[model samples]
Target: MPLPTQEKAAGMTTRGGSTSKPEKRQSGCGGEVKDRRTVEDRLDELLSSMLTRDYLDRQIKQLKMDIHAENKEITERLEGRIYELETDNEDLRKTVGSLEKEIESLHAARDKTEIKLNDLEQHGRKDSLRIIGLEDKSENESVEECVEKIVRFVTDKLEVSLNKNDINIAHRLGNFTRTKPRNIIVKFTSRRKKHDIIRARKKLRGSGQVIFEDLTRNNQQILKDAFRLKCVKNTYSIDGKLFAVLTNGKKRRLFMDTPLSEEYLMNDGNFRRL
Candidate 1:
């Protein structure tokens, strides 16, 4: 037997009488190039992520600053409004105080005026007399006849020396009615004559006749109220001044403003018990 010689390539190998191709070897420079490219790509990605995070941080900072400024403006506006409301409330309190003082002043002025008016009214009726229980004989009586009748009645009933000349005016007090006789009002020329008639009125006590001092309307009301009190035994008025004689032997001088009560009567120092 004779064997022929065979030529083999660089990566070819012969094993057990068979020939096989070996794997090709990679170059060392190519592996280094691939590793450098991967490192560059990772660095680029890191840089991009850093840039995006920095942009987001700047936008958030700007938004926070804007929100802070807006909140500050709103707080300042609220503070200003609170200050304005406080100022207005203070002004309103002052106005209310001023109005209350003004009302008090008005009330004081009105009370003084009323006192003066009541005094003047009483002064006007000082020389007048009111005769009650007198018969109304005729509704058509003339002024002269009325005067003569009053003069005669005063002379006979009260036993006073009154003439028609002493009477300045004489007339019935109210509108004439058929149910009862109206009272006669007589204004005398002098207070002395009027007082004399009043003093003599005690004689006609049981004769179904009454004579009053022609008191002011307020005094008359006071007398009426005084008579209604359980503590009062008698009530009368002299020259527009009211007097109440209590059951406890005390004489109380009353005015239009006097409080009509048992406590006031018993405790008043002005009215001494007899």
Candidate 2:
């Protein structure tokens, strides 16, 4: 009976020891699982930081590209505006050139017309003469008869014969009034006959009657001014020009186009530089 009891006790002790070993192994497994969980959390944090940095870098690069595109667009617009202004400036230059040429052509045309009008006026009064200080005609006598009588008197005084056909037209210049009898204007058939009458006018020096070449209104004014000078002996108009005979027997020619002022007359009509 004693041997059996001892065997039973030994069996109990062996069973207790096995139970303690299994408890220790379970604690060590719990500690290993906690450490694995800590390592996984750290890995997760690192991945999140890398994703945020990549996103920020992409945004910065995109911003730089947008700025470059905007700058390029502004430059193109400025260049286009400059080209437009240059084109407008060139067109204005051409317009100014055309206007200047037109003004020059107008000036040339005006000068040519003035010269032509002067020639026509001078040719119209070629064969006419003016007779001053003639006696008044009688009331019963016709104007033609009065003119014939004057012509006969002139021919007798000059000792030169003149035909009736030589005279084309003769008449008083203005109305025949009781107070003032107008001078006579005569047109001759030929220029030679008119010149002959002018040459013969010297024969009637003492006579009250005076004869002159028919002058334009402008020439008449010039002659009247010239005759006012003390040095001027005689003044005559021929072919639209005035001839002044000085008391010293020198001849001076004057044009109707040039006006004679008081200063010029005071200088004895010496308009030349000499």
Q: Give each model's clash number.
A: 0, 0
Per-model TM-score on C-alpha atoms: 0.69, 0.51
Which 10-residue span in candidate 1 carries the lowest summed lDDT?
A: 2-11
- Per-candidate Cα lDDT values, in order, are 0.84, 0.72
User: Could you tell me the TM-score of candidate 1?
Assistant: 0.69
Q: For this target, which candidate reaches the highest TM-score against the unseen true structure?
A: 1
Backbone clash total for model 1 is 0
The pairs that clash in candidate 2 are: none
Runs in model 2 lying further than 4 Å from the true structure: 1-119, 139-143, 259-274
* Cα lDDT of model 2 by residue, 1-274, tens digit: 4353453555432354342222222345465233555769988988787779778799888999999999999999999998998899899899889999998998878767754565466577788888877777554556688678667866887665677788888877767666755788888888988888878889888887788878777568778888887777888877666777767776677765444544554464465522
